[model samples]
Each structure stands twice: as C-alpha cells, then as structure tokens.
Target: MATAGGGNAHMVFRRYLDAVGLQGLASAEAAGLHTSEWYALSLITLEGSLSSGELASRTGLTTGATTRLIDRLERAGYARRAADPHDRRRVI
Candidate 1:
C-alpha cells in the first residue's frame, strides 16, 4: 500500500514519463526516425558514447536488432560508430 504522498509522487512520475514519451515521439517524427531509433539516440546522447552491445542491453533489444537500429541511425545521420580510443577491437 502507498501513502497519499507516495501515490501523488507516482502520478507525477507517470505524467512526466508520458510527457517525455510524447516529446520523444514528436522529436523522432521530426527527425524522420522510428521510436526505437529515437530511444537509441537518446541513450547514446545520455551516455555520450556507448558500444552497440551496451546499447542493446540498455534498449532491451537483441544484438541483431540493435545493429539494425544503429544502421538506421547512421543512415539518418543521427549517430556514428567509431573505434574505441583504447580498444581497437571495440566500437563506440
């Protein structure tokens, strides 16, 4: 059971999430991208840079799906993959 204050907080958080989702949808549409692409872009922007594997984990997408997502983002000029500075074998 939640206290009244806790319930209000939950409502506020839910509203915030809804607002963010709406904004994200609008942004994605403006950018000519799918919602998932926008989400991946958001994650990348938040992290500054991350590996595709890390992105997959964060997005709850499989490696192949994440790869495809990255492909679309790259094609749309929203993101780029580069070799990690210290690890040539890893991409960022």
Candidate 2:
C-alpha cells in the first residue's frame, strides 16, 4: 500500500513527464523536426556546443546514432559541425 505522499509524488512525476513530452512534441512539430532532433538541439543549446562523444553521453545515444542525428540537424540547417579550435583532431 502506498502512502498519500508516495501517490502524490507519482502523480507529480507523471504530470512532469507528460508536460515534457508535449513540449517536446510541439517544439519538434514547430521546427519540422523529429523529437530526437529537437532533443539534440535542446541539448546543444543548453551546452552551448558539444562534441559528438559528449552529446552521445549526455543524450544516452550511441556515437553512431549521435553522428546520424548531427547529420540530420546539419542537413536541416539546425546545426553545424566545426573543428575544435584547441584540438585539431576533435570536432565540436
């Protein structure tokens, strides 16, 4: 049996999830992008800029998936990849 506080916490968590899902859906639709793309864009915006590895870790996506996501964003004009200034071998 769950306590009232536990039930309330569950409700709050559910509502938060719903709100976040709706916002992500709406934003993706507005941008003519997939939800994952929008999510990646949001992460990039929050982080300013991140390398593919960093993005993968942050988003829980594999490196290959992150590469594809970045490719999509770049093709859609939502993102760009640039060489890291300090590290010639890295991209950001």
Tens-place lDDT digits, model 1, residues 13-72 = 989999998999999999899899888998998888899999999999999999999998
For residues 1-92, what per-residue lDDT tens digits would candidate 2 score against the true structure? 55466577788898999999998899899999988888889999988889999999988999999999999999999899999999999999
Candidate no. 2 TM-score = 0.83
C-alpha local distance difference test of each model? 0.91, 0.91
* Candidate 2 ranges with C-alpha deviation above 4 Å: 1-5
Cα distance off (Å), candidate 2, residue 54: 0.7
How many collisions between residues are there in candidate 2? 0
lDDT over C-alpha atoms for residue 9 of model 2:
77
